[model samples]
Each structure stands twice: as structure tokens, then as C-alpha cells.
Target chain A: MADYKNNTIPGLIGFFLLTYGLFFPSLSAEWVSFIIDRLQESMEIMDSGQLLIASFAYISRNALLYFLIYFSTLLIVSALTKNTDSIAFSFLFISATLTAVFLINEFYGESSSYAPHFFSLGLLLALNSYITKQRYYYLTFAVILFFLITAMQCLNLIPLLSQWSFGADDLAISLKTADSFITEDQLFTALYFVLFAIFFLIAVIFALLVHLFNIQITTLKRFQVQEKELKETRFALTESKVYEEIHSLVHDLKTPLVTVRGLISLIAMKYEKTEDKKLQDYLTRVDHSIDKMNEMISEILYENTKKEIDVDEFLRYVISHLVLDDQKIRLEMEVQENLPYIHVNKIRFARAIANLLENAIISFEGKAGFIQIDVKKVNDTVRFQIRDNGPGIKEELMQEIWKEGFSTKDSSGLGLSFVKRVVENHQGTIFVSSTPGSHTQMDIYLPVSSGQGGAFYDIDHR
Target chain B: MKKSSAVIGCFLAGLLLAASPFARPDSAASINSYPNLPAPIGEETILFTSAGQAPENLLLAKMAEDLHLEGDYRPRALASDLYDYRTLVIIVGNSPYGLQYRNKTFTEESDRIKQLLNEAELREVPVIILHVAGTKRQDNQTVELIETTAPYADYFLGLKSISSSTKIIESMDAANVPVTLVQDLEDLHTPLNSAFR
Candidate 1:
């Protein structure tokens, strides 16, 4: 998460900057020593109240110095890496280095008064690294801890500093000459215990705050995901309701279509032997138109009714529905031999193919154009590729062409959407490829039926 | 059994006898080691102050009170405080911490002591130098303060335990200032009481 490989060098640089800034001459450490010396002098002459006030000032000054160095290095590292996690890692690096320095100083018996405070700061920084997600919360806690630790150091309350030369020696010297010094020492010791309790309480409170914040964030994220799912469910429900209404309307229209078809059949039978040939041809054409309307109604109402049919027969049925009355367009068909049979709804699948052909023809705008249809077995699916040389679909409108109401011409835009739905319902995939002002290609793959093929073609003239 | 008890008692007596010389009263030895002052060198109403901003001035003030001597303690006493006092008792010791607390550099402290001593001389008040904190206080800063204030002092009182007491006494003797050495802090009241009226 920290991008360790990329951040290692910058992290190390930050660590060095922090370490050297604290310990280098005329830097934070020297400034702290100067202030400590002044505080020690003040402690010798001041009353109890003045002493407490001076100690607070001393602690604040040292805390501010350390914080400046620390925060500056943190900012520089953050800017260099431009990663949120890197700040935590850099803090960890700096804290560890300071800890090592503190341990070494402690082992050699040359520990400064502030060494324990640095060690405490390192522990807090390590805690910050462990909880990387809550950066702001941990950073605030770390700053507060830094101030408290600095106060602890200035008061000489840390056991190691107090028991050693800096605090103990001064106490021992004062003890020999004044009882008031004893009282001051006892008072500081009590203050130290009180501060220690507060430090522990603050740590607990910080942890609790982080926990509460995490719970709140998790709940918020969960609510967002649920809200998104709810919206999608509502949209799908509305789409299903519309489809149900359309299915009912198409079913109602089929009853009237049957009555008209029956009447035409009866009329054709009565005029079977008429001597006027033009009237007979007109009646035959009207019968054929009635059959086409019936097929269209079936396609809309029973799209899922499927059966196995030969790819060649299916293509033929699809081609028969196309009106190639325009003389300027040439349609070519290529069907590979021994192709697998496809399982599909005859009325719906044929109409879907006819819709694609009709779209290619309309793209020509009455100009001379070529349309190519190819049928082949690709693995287990039969791929039908339709290519047109008319002005191709624009790239930006490729996806829009499949929507239920999208069209470039003065017509209802249901053709491509219906084709896409029919193909998908029969376990097929369709893809379109086009270059603007050049050519458009559509490829549809339908899964091969596993069962034996059968002649299921039905043209109901009635 | 009786003879064994008598032997144990004799061993314990011998141990005490051997420790007796090391445990002699330090005040008696301190008095025997130095000659008493010819007479009380200064009067009451003394001004107790520090030449080097040392806390010893506080201890000297306490010692003055124990001897029923009227005195006021001011670790940072200026030359103006010398007008009402008949005798000035200056504690000579350096504490860098104390100097810093008073916000005075060593040079500034020495100058203040010099001015106070000059004012004491102008007022014809007797100046007594007390160097009670022993060898530990004999740093360069304290030694410089001693050199600065020693020329105007009528008497020099120091703890005998100080390693540089001989040199300090030699300088005071060369300056014809009376020198008194005490064995410890408690022994300070003897010379202090005698020096006050």
C-alpha cells in the first residue's frame, strides 16, 4: 500500500532529516538544552507557582521545536512521494531510527533527558503506522502525545531521567540544604503520576474515537451500496412492467388478425376459378400481406418459442422477408456446407435478421451499394456476418444503435434493439464493427442445437 | 558462656575505640585548627548577599539568624542595598544555574559585586567574605568572584574542606585580610557570630 520500493529512498531521506534536525548543532536538541538550562536556573530561584509556570513554558517550547522538525519532514516526504500511505511509512522509519538512537544512548549510559520522550514518540508513531487508514485521527493523537511526553520530560517524571544524574543529582543537592526542596520534589512526583494517568486515558480515548469513526465509515459505505442496488432493482421492475403491457397488447391484436386472415382465405377459395387474372393476382398479393402481418405479430408475442433448423433454411427464410425492390443494391449470400443447425424461434429470429438487412439497405439512401452475408461454423456456434458498403455507422453512435428508441432516420428505432434481444434470448452474442463513412459489419453467433435437426418451417397463409 | 560474652564485649569496645578519632567533633577540631578572631570585627544589621549568585547566601542568612544577628538576604543585591547595612557578608560561590536564573552573565555578576564592594568601601562598612560550600564550589567562576571581592573584604571565612582554601587564605593574608576556616557548614556559625559584634 505504501509503494515501498518507490518510497524507500524518500522515506530514508525523511528519516535522516528528522534525526539530524533534532541532534545537529544549533538545531532542536541544542535549542532544547539551552531552554532546559534556563529552566533549571529559574527553578532554583522561583516559588512553586512560578516554577510550575516556567516548566510549562519550557515544555511547550521544546514540544514546538520537535513538532516543527517532525511535521516539516513529514510534509516534505508526503510531497516527494505524493502518497497517503507513504507519510505513515516515513513516520515509522523516522520513529524507528530515533528509537534505535535512544536505545543506544541508554545502553551507553549517556542518555539525554529527552531520550525517553523520543522513545515514547517513536512508540506513538509506530501505532500510527499500524493504523494507516485513520491518518488524520492518528496524527492528531500523535501531536497531543508529543506535547504530553515533552511535559513529562521537562518535569523529569520519566523514571530513567528522574533516577539518573539530571533529576536525582539536583534533588539530592537541594535535599541537603532545604526542606522546601523536598516538598517541591514530592509535588512534582505527584504531578507526574497525575499526568501519567491522563496520558493513559487520552490513549484509550483516541483508540475509542478511531473505532467509532471506522464503524461510521463502514456503515456509510454499506448504505451507499444498498442504495445503488435498490435503484437498479427499481429500474428492472419498471422495464419488466412495460414488456408485460406490450405482450398483452400484441396478444389482443392477434385475434383480429386471425379473423382477417380467415376472411381472405374464404375469398381466395371463392375466386379460385375467376377468369379475370388481374383480380386474382391482387387477391393473392393481399393474402401474402396478411400472412406477413401474422408473422410479425407472432414474432413480437412468442419470441422465446424456439426449434432446431438448418442454418441454410434459416438464412433462406430470413432472405425471403427482405424487400430488394431497389435496383441499385446488390445482396450476396455465402453459406458454408455442413454447418450446424441453430436452435431459435423461427418468426423472431427471421425477423431479427431481416431487420439487419433492412437497415443495410436504408443506409444506401437509394445509391448503388453492396451487402454481403456470410454463414459459417465457428467452434460450436454458427456465426452470421452481415457487411454493408453503404455509408457506415459513426463510431460515437455504435452503442446508441442498440437502444430501444435510437435512429438517424425518420422512423421508429426498434429494429436493432429487437434484433439484439432476439439474438440474446436464444443464447447468442452479437457484435458490430464500423468505420465512419466507410463500411459497417455486424457479426452474430448463435449456439448450435445439440439435438437432431428437423424441418419445422411453417408459413400460415390463413 | 560468661567468658565468651566478656570477649564479645571487649571486641565491641575496641571497635568503638578505633572509630573514636575518626568520629571526633568536627566543630572542636575546626576551632582548634584556626586562631580565634582578635575581637568581633563587625557590628549587627549586616547585609547578606552573594558575589556569584550562589544559594550559599541563603544558608549564610540562616546562620546569621541563628547567631541573633540582624541581616537581610538578597542573592541579587545591588550596590544601592548597601546604604543601610553596617556590615556586608558576601557568600563567594558560583552556580551557573543561579546566574542564569538572575539573568546575569559571570562578567555582569562580577561587575555588580565590584560595584557593591566599592559602595561598601565608600560607606565605611566592613565587608566579610564567606566561602562555605567547600571544594565543590571552587570552580573558575567562583575563584574569579573571590579575586574580584577579596581585595575589599576585612575578613575571609571559608570551609576548611575546600581544596583551594590554602590559596584563598594566602591571598587574603597577603591582602592583610583576616582568614577563618571552618570544618563544616555547622562550624560556620562560630566565625559568623564572632565576626558580628
Candidate 2:
């Protein structure tokens, strides 16, 4: 459509040439008939009345023919070009050219009976353009102007045109005579003017309506865009406020843990020289548990505190966090030899994996179910696969499970969403596949750490 | 682009030059063919009208006045207009614009003319068919009108220069009606004057 509009000028030129080429001969024939009839009248072979009627008939026929040809050509050109603007422009150009020719003929002292007919044709062409392309104010103006011009020309009210005498060179004078005869019928003459006025009013009202409609649509689209932007800004503000509150709450938790750890160290020092080994060992285990808790707090408060941990060691930490006391559920683990270490926040990464295991165990609802964990290296990353034979997640609920506050069970729905956040923060990816009423599997890939330490590095927890 | 424009201009010029001759009216000498029988005459108070509502009725009306023929001119005269009329002179030609201005379709016009002709036949009013606009008025619709009105017409008058004058002559000959083919509208004055008185 844009391309068609862009080429409108060229298209107009082409159509103008086509219209002139097609109608030239018909116009010429009308002129020639008028001249011949006048000559016959001079020879006393035909009377003035017959000459006048013949001239009127020939011009009227040509006018009707030209109207048909112009209308059909516009339709065909519009169809071929798929451009109404171009066709309307072409029609206007041709109509103007015809009007110019009529005016030029009149100025040269030749009275053309077909001049008003051609002007009327121009009025019709303008009306067509106004109706089809009402958005263009120029076309509406053209319609109004053409209608007035046609009325003036038809009524012989044009001061300059009325001064000219009917010459033998042009046959269109007979049309002027016919108009005089028609005007003698007062009702018909009034009705004709009324019709033209009505059409002009209709064109003006329609153009105004179209203009208002376009403005309304533009305003509506603008409001829609602003509404969408406001929604996104409000959502982002809410997310940031939640993160700020969580960070403040976690920072306050470190104070109490620090005092408890210092008191336990003091008690261990007092019992160091005594022969009480079991008590000493128990105290050491308590101190180590406090340290692990502190590490988890650090992981929550900050995201960048990460260290490399062996894949197998990470799996053991995850299992230790889960309670496997339920008899209806069984757990299995498989770790490939020489698996690459993954760089991640140990406490949060283990907690995310533990949440998955807990969800799997809960899915059993006290029914017998088996959960299997597999760790292996592929390319530059380590993958963990956790499979469970239980009531699997439905296809529709799979994506929803990872959204905050979305859950199908009687629990806070933050488990999967938290897991997804932790994995994404560590630049890892998680995927899930499930068969409803059968089994479910989850795969997590974490990029391997560049550093290599002892093959069996351990983190103690009591 | 300039070359293409020039070529198209040349092509269009050739077409215009080629079509100029065809656009001119036939320049051959007019032929006047009359039947052997004397022209039929009708009483005064003739009804001058049009068969297909052409503007030619106005011209014919003027011609009737010039010939001192007393008649009423009704371009869209209905069958009821035939009251007390002794002769019906209908100018036969079709103008699409004329029909449109009068808010009539070809079918309605044809039916109206048929009704008027039928009323004339019942009233025994002498009907004369005139085809005066020459070949410019000859079309399928006008030809059909002529054919439909021929059988009821008592006399046929038309121009000799029109190409379809042959068809009009043929229809009149087939209907066994006397037809007068004249050189121009002026020549129709003599025959028309004779027919009225």
C-alpha cells in the first residue's frame, strides 16, 4: 500500500495519458458533426431546429460515453494498482485538463455546447474521489468547487462565458439552448439545483466524520501504549521493594549467631585439659554446625560469595538436608567418575536441590515412590538429573510451578521459584519433563569451575 | 523514460490520425426513397411525441409548428394523452441520459411506448414513426423500439443518411407501411405537411 502511494504521481501521469488517448476521437467526432450539421444548415438542406437537436444529441451521447469510459477506467486502474489515491489523482488531473480545454475553446470565441457537460463530468469525477478517499480534504474541496462551476456553466451564469456568442465552430451551443428550454420548467430546474446542493452537503459531512474518526483512533492507540508502560513500571517497583526487605531481615539474623559461636568456643577451651573427649567432640560438632548456619546466612545476604565444590560433595550436602524417614519413599544416587566441580553458593545450591527432593517426597502422599539422583559431566558443564516415580506434574502446571505464589499443594508456593532464581543467579539452567500419573524428571546444568582441588574435599556439618 | 514517453505519444498520435476519418459523418449524397402510393393524410390536432423519450421530440415539435400543424407536444406522453387526437407523430430515438432524467429504465420506456401504441390502435388514430437523429441515434435499444412500433405505424419517416435507415426501411416494408426517406430534416416538412392535411 505504501509503495502504491509512493508511485502515485507516475501512475496519475499514465492514467491521464490513457484517458486522453481513449476519449480524444470521441470528442473530435462530436466537434466534426456539429461543423457538418451547421454547414448543411447553411446549404438549406437542414433547418436550424434540426441542427440544434442534432448538436445536442451528439454532445449528450459523447458526454454519457465519456462518463462511462472515465468511470470504468478509474475502476480498472484502481484494481490494477491497488491504489485509490493514485486513481483519484489521475481522475482529477484529467477532469482539470478537460475543463482547461473547454475554457480555452471558450476564450478563443468558440462556444462549445459540450463544455458544461464536461464540467458536469468533472463534478462527477470529483464526487467519486470524495466518496472513495474522504480522508483527503483536497478532494472534498474539489468536489464542492466542481459542483459550483458545473452549476454556473450549465445555467450560463458565468459572466465571461455568457458574453460569448454561439459560434459555428463548436456545436455545444445547442446544449446551452437545451438548458434554456429545461429551465423553462421551473420545478425541474429547482430540483436539479437542489440535488447538487444535497450532494455537496453530504460530501462535506462525510469528510468531517472521517476526520473525527481518525483522531479518535489515534488517541485510543496512544492511551493503550501508556497503560502498558505503567503496568511494567509498577511491577518492577514492587519486585525491588521485596528484595530490599528480604536483605534487611537476613542481615539482622547474623548478630545472635555470632554470640552463640563465641560462647561455645569459650566453653570448649575450659574443657581442653580435662579427660572428657566425648564432651569435647560434641562441642566441636556444635561449633561446626554454627559455622555452616553462618555460611547459609552469608549466601542469602550476598549473591557473589561462591566457591568451587565437587559434584558428589554437593549431592551429599543436598541429601543431608532432606529427611528420608518416610518409609513410602526410597532414594538412589549415581555419580559418574571424575565429574567436574561446579562453582556455586554451596548452602543455597544445596538448599535448592533439597527443596526439589522434598517436593518429590511430598508428591508420594505416603504412597511408595522412588527418587533417583544422577550427576555427570558433559562438555563444559556438570548436569544433575533428579527423577521420581510419583504423581507427576501436569503439563499445564509445569511452567506455573516456577512462578512465585503458584502452587497446587498446601504449602507456600515459593519453593520452585526460589530454586529457579538460585540456579539462574549462578548462570545455570534448569529443565523439567514429566508424564502425568507416572513419573517426573528435572535436569540442572551448572558451568564447571576452572579450579581443581583435592578429589574429596569435604565441608563438615553436624 | 523520455524515450518510452515519446514512443507512447507517437502510438497515441497514430491512433488519433487513423480514427479521424471514421469520426467524420458519412459524406455520401443523401438518397430519398419513397413508396409508390400517395402519402396518407390525417386530420388536425396531431399528437407530437417521442417513442423512447428522446430530446428529438422538442425538435420535431418545432418542425410541426413551422409546418403549421396543430398538435400537442408531450415528450413523455402516456396513452391517456391520445384523447381527441386524430394523429400521433412519434419521433423514434433512444437517449440514455434522457431516460435517466425522466427516471425510466429501458424496459419501462419500451412498455410505455407499447401501451401508447396499443391505445392508438384501439382509437384508430393514425400513427407516424419518425427516425430523425440519423445514425447517431441508432443503437440496439432504439432499433428494438423501431421494430416494436413499425407494425402499428401508418407511415414511416427517417433520414436517408443514417446507416440504420436500411433497417428502418426494412421494418416498414415488412409491415407493409409506406416509408419516406428524405435527405434531411428540411425535406420531412413537405411529406409531413402533406400527411396532416
Candidate 3:
């Protein structure tokens, strides 16, 4: 968790002090063994027991040296750059793994050999960060650091390391040096270091590449989700397109129909004056068909585009305009006075609601019946329930009731279908239930307001 | 570039003269630990980060070679060729197992490991995970996943002792392959950890 570069000195001091505390005598005695070991083969300066003691002493001192350097470096680096950026995580993981490897190698490893595990750990950390987010220059720096490591390690793994003997202390040639005491085998060791360095560096690069691929694949999935959302938003916008096309079609038809009607009336008036009863009757039929077509177009346009009008005002307009068969209708109305302004296209909602009420009014088959209309705001919801005491719809026809043109006593089949569309556009739910003679009920649930200034809401059916 | 040239020189020289004159492959190739022992080829060993050290990588490589498997020092590279070989040695990667090591988010890097482990099962590859493999339980999902995955492994060897009954310490029971503790090999140097090669 710590990233320090400058604080490493104190950290190094603390680490060495801790390790040294565990082996003060041995660390102090390490130099003695080291000196004797150098002159060993010729003079046999140390005995087997002394040599054993010396090896342990050397290992303890090395452990102290490593602990001091690694922890101190970690502390300073982590401290200098408080680990906030994404790379910080990688740094900590690398440092921790390095520390673990160093500790294990220190406590249990051979005195004559070394392990480059921490170097690998460091490289993995740096590579992991670049792969995590794929910033540009990260990989370039990684390659440079790797090259430096390989070059230095080669120096110690091959003969150049062993080429320097007991008398070569004055060489002071390179800080990248291996154990000076083991001068005879230095060449072999240096070579080993170099080969291992290159191989391990390649391995680190390989891990980074794999990490990069996985990140890209995961991002691809997110892009796919965004694409799906875009398609849906476009589909939602299509409603407006269709409505515009329908309006223009109505306007075009109306102009031609008005001309035809005017011409027919002029002809019919002239013909009636000449005592032609047949022509008058035929022209009246033509006039009726044109009136019906105009009415139908208006309803379709109103239903398609949902713009709300006042529920009370819209209700009165529907009753006055669509007075189906006033005979069997015993109309009863109950509505809340505290009702807020509803957002629905007035023309569309009025036609849809009237269509349903008209169905209820005429369902008794021209027989006398009671029709109930209730609109009340309960809690945060406004519910519209219409019930009638008629023979109720036949059980077989219940499912078919909402389908266009499936009406039992119908003219055009579009009325109920239009009602369903308007209700859905207002973000409302509709339910239907019927009992033989008791009643047939059509209930609706809709939100009174949407707050953001639109009558429309997202509609989903599952 | 000079360093590379020096390396090439040393490599040729080392190839010519073996570290010990008698230990050359041509000479030692005939030596066998068992009657059917195969000559050791170039090793594709991997040193994983399990046990927070490179124990998985090092231990797995040693065991693989002992069992006549081919591998090398860094196992990450083998990621590409994982399914190509007859047998492979894997040291489990590092994981935040103990509460002392818990961080904020989950580390699914091991998800790659789990993928390889499953593929190995299909290809009949037997893998060995060290002691740290038994310790990953930071949440319910991980605990469930570990339990789910434990049954798929053909040979599950544990480096340290575990508490579960079916989890024996290496008696070679397949239905309940146990954790086996092997005697330590040469421990590596601490100074070498921070050192270059």
C-alpha cells in the first residue's frame, strides 16, 4: 500500500536494524569468514566447524542486506507517490510479492546462490499496470527497464564476474557485480544471470499482453450494451414519424372529398328540380360514405399521438358527441374534485374513453341496464373503472374483445383497439372481468402526473 | 547490444564446457531414477505466486520434472501453449486468502487459472497447487466456487495440512486426493530476490 522513493533510506535503516537485531554477532563475524574463505583453498584458513559457522554468518548478513534494501526502497517509492492512480494497485501487488520472495529466500535459501524472483515481481507489477488501462508510454518504459536488467544480470552470470580474483578489489569497474569471494566460478554465474534475465523478461511481457486482451474483450461487451440502447431510443422516436405521415394523408384526402361533395350537391339540386328522385338518393349515399371516412381519419390521428386534455372536460365531450342509444343508459358518475391535471392528448383519450363507455351502454342489446363510471384518486394513483349490468360478454368472446374488429355489435373494429393504444401510451394498466348477469367490468390504472412535462411514458409488456 | 554479444559468447562457451565435466546430458542421459525413466528434455517450468512467494511455480516445476513432465522457469508464457502439451505443471497464482490480506475488491485474475484448470481436466492434465490454494475465502461466492471447482481436479496435492476430512495429506485417494507435504528442496537466496538475474 505504500509507495516511497526518498523515505527508502530510513526504511532501509529500520529493516537492517531489525534483521541485524536477530543476528548482530553473526553479521559482525561475516567479514571474518568472508576474508578467510577468500584465502581458503591454499591455507585452509578455516576448519569445517568454522566454515559452517561462516556460511551461516554470511547468509545472515546477506539476509540483513536484502531486507534493508528491499523494504526501504518500497517505503520510499510508495511514500513519494501516494498510490492513487490505477498503477498504484499494481505497484503494491508487485512490492508485496517481492518482499515475500525476498523473505523466503533470505530465511531458507542456499548461501552460494541467488534468486531473481523480486526482479520478476517488479517487472510483473509494471507490466500489470500498463495492461490494466493501456496508457501509451507504460510499455516503452517497461522495455527499457527490462533491457537494463538483462544487461546487468549477464555481467554476473558469466566469466567476467569470476575473472576478477582476490587481488582485483581495486578494479572498481562495475556496481553490477556478483559475490567477489567466489572469483573462480564467476564466469559461469554471470552467464546464468544473463540468460535467466532475458527469458524472465519475455515471460513478463507475455503476461502483460494477455492482460491487455482480456481488458479489451470486457470493454467490447459494454459497447454492445450501448448499441442496443441506441436502437431502442430510435424505435421510441418512430411514433412521432408515423403520426406525421398519417396527418398529411388526412389533409390530402379531405381536399378531394370536399370538392366531390360540392359537385354532387350542385348536381343533386339541379336534378331534383327536374324531378329526378333516383339521382338524389344516390348522391345522399355518396355524401354519407364521405362523412364516415372523415370521422374515421380524425379518430385514428387522435389515438396515435397521445396528447392529454382535462379528464372532466374530455368526459363531457365524449358523452355529447357519442350519444349511442340514449334509451338503455342509466348513467351514473363519481369522480374526485381534487384531481390534478392529467397529461394525455385530449382528442385521443376522449375518443378512446367514449368508445369503451359506448360499448358498455349498448352491451344490453338495446335492453334497459345500469352503467357506472367512477374516477377516483386513491393514494398516488388515479383509477378509472367502468362496470355495467348487462348480459356480460360471452365467455368465448372475452379474449377476443380487445382484438380489432372482433366486436359482437360493431361497426368498424378499430374503436376498442384504439382505446387500448391510448391507455398504454399514458403508462396505464387495463383489466377486464365478467360475470353472467352480475356485471362486466373494465378497470384502468394510470399515474396522474409524470413531473418532467410529457404525457408519454416508457411502455413495456411482458 | 554489447551485453547481448557478451551473452552470445558466454552461451557458446558454456555449451562447450559443462559446469561439471561428468554432468553433461550425453553422459548423464543414461542415468535413470526408475527403470522406465525418460531422458529429461528442456524444461518448461513455471514459478507461480502462491504462498505469496514463488513456491507454486518452483515446487510445481520440481514435481513435474520428477514425474517426467517438460516445463521451464516462467509459467506465464505457457499460457498460450497450455492445451498443446501432453502434460503441464502449474503453480497456483497468488490470491488474497487470509483476512490479513483482504483488499476492497475481488481478484478474478485467478479466473484465468480456473479456466486453464478446467481445460487441463478435459485434456487429462493433473495439476498440483501449493498450501496457499486452500486459503482463498474472502466471500461467499469464492467459497462456493472453490468448493465447486475442487471436485474437477484429477490430482489435488496440498503443500500444507488442511482441516477438511476428505482433504487428506497425500495418501493418493482419487475421490479424495489429499494434500501431500514434501520435504523442502534448496531454498533460494533472499538477496537474489531484488537482484537482477
Candidate 4:
């Protein structure tokens, strides 16, 4: 059996010893006193051998009564409840047993006073842990048991349960009174049977409660898990929807842009021998717009790569996508060699940084702009600072730039938000600052192995 | 709890005393000099260390030598053993001892040395570690253990080179106990010689 199962035997012995020591300091002497007094009273009625044997038998019987009552309390608890919360109940049961044992060893044994309350509390607590964890069930069981036990006590059914007892005269009178109402042997017999019934009733209630609530708790937990799964499903659906919309939009625009480029090339071919000022300027402007469109499409396609991409590689890819004709727009990076990699969504994050490049390029629309991208590993985080000496975003437009779809141009303000999403996903952050004509700087922060050089303890759920 | 702890403590002390054959301290260990006396006092503290097995006669002989204000060099015959928590207890048995025992505790002395260190610490005594994680078995953890234990000591020393940077000190604790590095040992001579005078 488990440690809690065979607890009563030791508990009962401990209780007996504890109470015996506390109340009856001189236990053996007290028992001798009671036996001697009894012998003196019945001295004339029996022979010496018979008197000696009878007195010894009487003391033995009283000792046996204490053990019986102790065992009976345990049996009642054991039979009535299977839930172990009854440690407190068992304690009360032990206390009552101890008190009852002390009283029995007394010359004039009487009924116990606290027997009903402790038995009620102990049984209820133990039953609470086992039978039902619900507050109402516990309160209800406690009330019902209390009333039932109290009702049994009124009928002289609760053992070691009686009122004031006088001496021998009182005992004789009470027995005679009890005999007149009912047979002497039948008084506690019904109570004993009722106690057994209480035991069985408690056991049955305990089993049923565990059975009912076990099902409820398990069902509740399953439902919570399902709810979490449903939430994740909704998020995944939203992401896929956004992805589908962008992919189709880019695909449809590809054909028209290619046709427009073809027409521009045809015009340039037709005017191959002509050296007119207006024609050259028009052709040059047309070529520049085509370059811009091509770069935008390239950015759109590259942004859709699903795998995690190295941040530095993604930076280089973004620069290449820009199609910079002027060597000045080609960003010079002071990146350290073989830098530690930061976790990034290749497509989405590349798009965000690419948009920053696009803005820098546009700000220099008529004049050449010098853009510099620096990637540094400081301690454990990667810091990417993209600086541009473009018409550094107008002071009034700076705040509105990051607001989604609130772009100065026709494109969505989603680029910065997308960048934010990528940075946040990598347990990092982004910052934007513009000196309004001197330079515009967008800095992104991403952690690399958490500052402890070389190793990160990953709780890998994937 | 106190009685059980005391019992374990006594068992730890008795084992350390029994294992070091040269560690037997005569009552008048003070009236003796180094390299002539069976055991020397007022000498540098010597600690024999390896992996797995606890140094026998580890702390007592040091403490007994220290009582007479001698250079307390406690010698330990190291038995290679490895105690790891994430993995099973792996005994790297390449010591001078002829018998090869696995991860299991070979004797009571080995089992109690760690406790002896803890007890010695309670009394405010410096612990001299002499771990022998040789070149054949060098790693990050061995380097870390060597570095961590070095600072708490008044004069830090090691028997074997754990890293390329650590300088090996040829000075003995007196008699034949060898230490690899003796940081701050030069500063100790003035006070030691004054006491000697």
C-alpha cells in the first residue's frame, strides 16, 4: 500500500500514547486504583480466586475497549472515505479516540462531548479531497453528515456519545432507564450498524464524486487546448491571405511593366541615328523609370522567400536589387568578416530594408545620394544602421512614414511595419531618425546568441 | 539532523586521516624540519588532485601541519575519476593505482573529500587544488574549474598546465610535493622567514 494508506495504525498508537501521557500521568496506578475499588465493592459476592480473576478481566476489558474504539474510528473513516484529505479528520478521529480511551480507563466512564463535531469535521475534510473537490459538494456533504450524525446521536447511536454520568448509582439508574425503554444489549447495536452505514455511504459518495469531476476537469483542459489551437489557426489564415494578395498583385503587374519596357526599347531603337536633345532626355527618363519598376519587382519577389536568411546576405541582396547605375548609390558596408548570423525571415525583412533603400533613392530623385549600410556585432546583438544623405524625409512626413499604408508615395506604409514584425520576431527592435536634409538613419537591432559568446541553450520545441 | 550531519562529518574526517600513509602527524610535528622529518610543518600547503577520486588524507595533514605554524603542503595521490551530473559518473581511471575502477566510489576517502573541503571552508582555511586534467583530456570545463578555484587562495598553484598561458612554478611545498604555478609565493617569503627567525 501507499504511505498514506497504512497511516492509521501508527497514528492510532501515537494518539493513544499521547493522550494517555497527557491526561493520565499515573496510568497504571489509576487502573490499579479503579480495579481495587471495584474489588472492595464486590469483595463479599465472590471467592478470592474468582475475585482476582474478575478484577484482572475487568481491567483487561477496559484496555481492550480503548483499542476497539480507536480501531472503530479508523474503520469508520477508512470505510466512509477514500480521499486522503482526512488527515485533519484522522487527527480529530485520533483525538476523539484518545479522549474516549482516557475516559474508559477512568473509574466512572462517561460519554464523550467533542466526538460529534470532530468526527463531522474530520470526515468532511477527508471526503473533500477524495469525494469531490468542488466547494458546494464539500459544504453539502459536511452539512448532511453533521445532521445525520447528530440525528444518530439523539437515538444513542453515536458511540462514546452520551451526556453527564453520575457514579455507580447513576450508571445503575441510567441502565435501568435504558432497559425500560429498550433492551440493554440493543442500545449501541443500532448505532454501530448506523456507523457502518455511514462508512459505506461516504465511500460510495467519494467514488462517484471522483468519477464525475475527473471527467469535468479533463474535458475543461481539452477544450482550453482546442481554443488555443483555434487561435493559432486564425493567425495562420491571416498570414496566408496577406501572402496570396501580394503574390497575385506582383504577378499581374509583371506583364504590363515588361510591355512598357519593350515599347521604350523600341522607341530608343527607332531613334538610333537621331541625336536630338529632347529625344535623348525623354529616353533617359524612360530608362530610369523602367529601372525603378524592375528593382521594385525584384524586391517583391525576393521578399517572398520562406526560409530564414542570414541578415548580412539579405542586406547585400537588397543592394543588388536596387540596380544602382551611379557608384555613389551603391552602399558601402563596414561589416565585420564572417559575422555571427541573426535569425531573420529572408523575404519579409529584405522587403522592409529594400523599401528603406527605395526611399533613399527617391529622395535623391534629381541628384545623386550617398547611402551607407553598416552591420556590426556588439556583444551579442547585430546592429544594422542604414544611413542616407538624401533629402532626409521632410520633418513633417517623418512620423507618418511608419504608419501602415500612410506612405508619401502610392505604395502601402506596410514596409516599416513589416520591418517591425521581422525585428520583433527575432527578439529585437528598430529605430528611425532623420536629420531632414543631412541624413536619414534607420537602425535595426537583432540578438545573436544572447551575449554569451558561442552558445545559446535553446528550448527547442520545433 | 545535527547528529546525522555530525556522524557523516566524523566519517569524512576519519577516512581522510587513514588514506594518506605519510599524513600521520606526531604530536610534536613542530620540532622538525623539511626533507628530514617524516612530515613537515610551516611549509606551503600541498593538495593532490585528479578527476573522480577524492584525495586521501586531504585536509587533516594540512590542518595538523598548520597547527605548528609550518608551511603546510598536503600531498595527495590522485586517482583519475570524473563526476558529471548531465551524464553518468564516468571514471577516467589512468592514475598510478594498478586497479581500474569505474564510476563507482573506490573507497570511503574519495567519497568524503568534497565534504572535507566544505567543512574546511567553514573554518576559514584556504583550499589548495591540484587537479590533473592532462593534455589528453583538456577542455573548456577543466579550464573553468582551474580559473574559478585560483582566486580564493592566498597563493594559487596548479600541478599540470591547464592552459598555454599559465606559467608552471617548480617550487615544492617542501619535501617532494610539486605545484605548477605559485602566484604570490614570492611575497610570502618575508613573513615566513621572519617567523622562522
By lDDT, the candidates rank as 1, 2, 3, 4
Give per-residue CA lDDT, model 3, range A31-89, as digits (tens).
53352333232113213343334333333443344443333444444444534134443
Candidate 4: tens digits of C-alpha lDDT, residues A1-462: 775655555455545644553344234444434433443233223234433343343324333333345444544444345443444444545455555545654533222223333333334334444444544543444444443343323323322222221111212222222221223324444534565467547554655666588779879989999997786577567767988898888878989999998998999899988979799889989889988677666656654323445766777777778767754565677787778766555556666678777777777875866788888886677878888887666667665665445566666446665666656655666777777658878777677753333321111110
Against the native complex, each candidate's DockQ, computed on alpha carbons, is 0.03, 0.03, 0.01, 0.00
For model 2, the local distance difference test gives 0.63
- Runs of candidate 2 with Cα error greater than 4 angstroms are A1-218, A312-338, A350-375, A385-424, A429-443, A450-462, B1-68, B71-197
Positional deviation of A3 in candidate 3, in angstroms?
A: 26
lDDT string for model 1 (B46-144, tens) is 898987765434566656667888878888888998888899989887755456546778788888899999999999999999886554344556777
For candidate 2 chain B, which ten residues in a row score worst on lDDT?
B1-10
lDDT of 3 at A156: 30
What lDDT does the true structure give each of the candidates?
A: 0.63, 0.63, 0.46, 0.45
lDDT measured at residue A265 in model 2 versus the true structure, 0 to 100: 85
Per-residue lDDT over B1-197 for candidate 2, one digit per residue giving the tens place of the 0 to 100 score: 33233224433443444344356444233323563226456778998887766544466776786887888888788899898798998888775545644668889999888998999999999898888755445556788999999999988787665533456666777898776767656677878877865
- DockQ score for candidate 1: 0.03
Candidate 4: misplaced stretches above 4 Å? A1-221, A304-347, A350-381, A384-462, B1-197
Best by lDDT: 1
Per-structure clash totals for the candidates? 0, 1, 38, 20
- For lDDT, candidate 2 versus 3, the one ahead is 2
